[model samples]
Target: MTYTAMKTLSVDYRLERWTGTAWVTFKMSSNNATNTNLLNATSDWTVMPGYYYRVTSIHTAYDGSTTETSKHVSGTVLF
Candidate 1:
């Protein structure tokens, strides 16, 4: 089975993945005032017939500039 998740964040903000004890960072940019930007993360897994995996954490940042905004959400996966 495969697991896929997508997240969108505004200008100056970013998303980072946790590698057990540390974080791998990814950056995003927005050039339009009204455009929605997105960030995506994916993972693959194989399990028993009744198994599942979960997304544990999401990290968000907003670059304290006066011209941009940001938002975030986190959840689990069921298959």
Candidate 2:
């Protein structure tokens, strides 16, 4: 039996705020790894008192020949 490993892994983080009409990205950050399979990130931003905010993350993993990607969005909160 044989096993495989990913060549690279990365994530894109976006902080979004709900405007009166649509969601807008207020801040952004990212983390990546070239020799490992783990990634961690943290972000902090001040929000207005009467707006909704959330985080959206896009994760991607790639081997030598193939790539896989996924997206996750956190639950919205009012501040």
Candidate 3:
């Protein structure tokens, strides 16, 4: 038996650029998230054409049963 399950969410955004070797991570988030100006409005990083970038959303959920689950966006960016 379980008493109650509590849920919490913390959402953050990031825009990463490919440096030919590795993918760098940057802090990215917007109060009004849009596709028109996703990086321009939300991130401090600049957008470059022909460069691979990845937008990852990490999710973590926990309940009162001491069971926790975490999920991450998969796949690579091909620019």
Compared with the true structure, model 1 gives a TM-score of: 0.26
lDDT scores in order? 0.35, 0.82, 0.50
lDDT of 3 by residue, 34-71 (tens): 22212122345667678788876543333534434444
Give the per-residue lDDT digits (tens) of candidate 1, residues 1-79. Answer: 0122213232333344444566444333332222233444444434333323333333332333332333543443334
Candidate 1, residue 41: lDDT: 43
Looking at model 2, report the run of 10 residues with the lowest lDDT sum: 1-10
Q: State in Å the error of residue 2, model 2.
A: 16
CA lDDT, candidate 3, residue 45: 61
Cand. 2 TM to true fold? 0.85
Prediction-by-prediction clash tally: 0, 0, 0
- Find the 10 residues in a row with the least total lDDT in model 1: 1-10
What's the lDDT of the predicted structure labeled candidate 2?
A: 0.82
* The best candidate in terms of lDDT: 2
Ranking by lDDT: 2, 3, 1
TM-score of each: 0.26, 0.85, 0.49
* Predicted candidate 2 versus true structure: per-residue lDDT over 1-79, tens digit per residue: 0134468888899989999899999889998877566666777777678889899999988887888899999999988
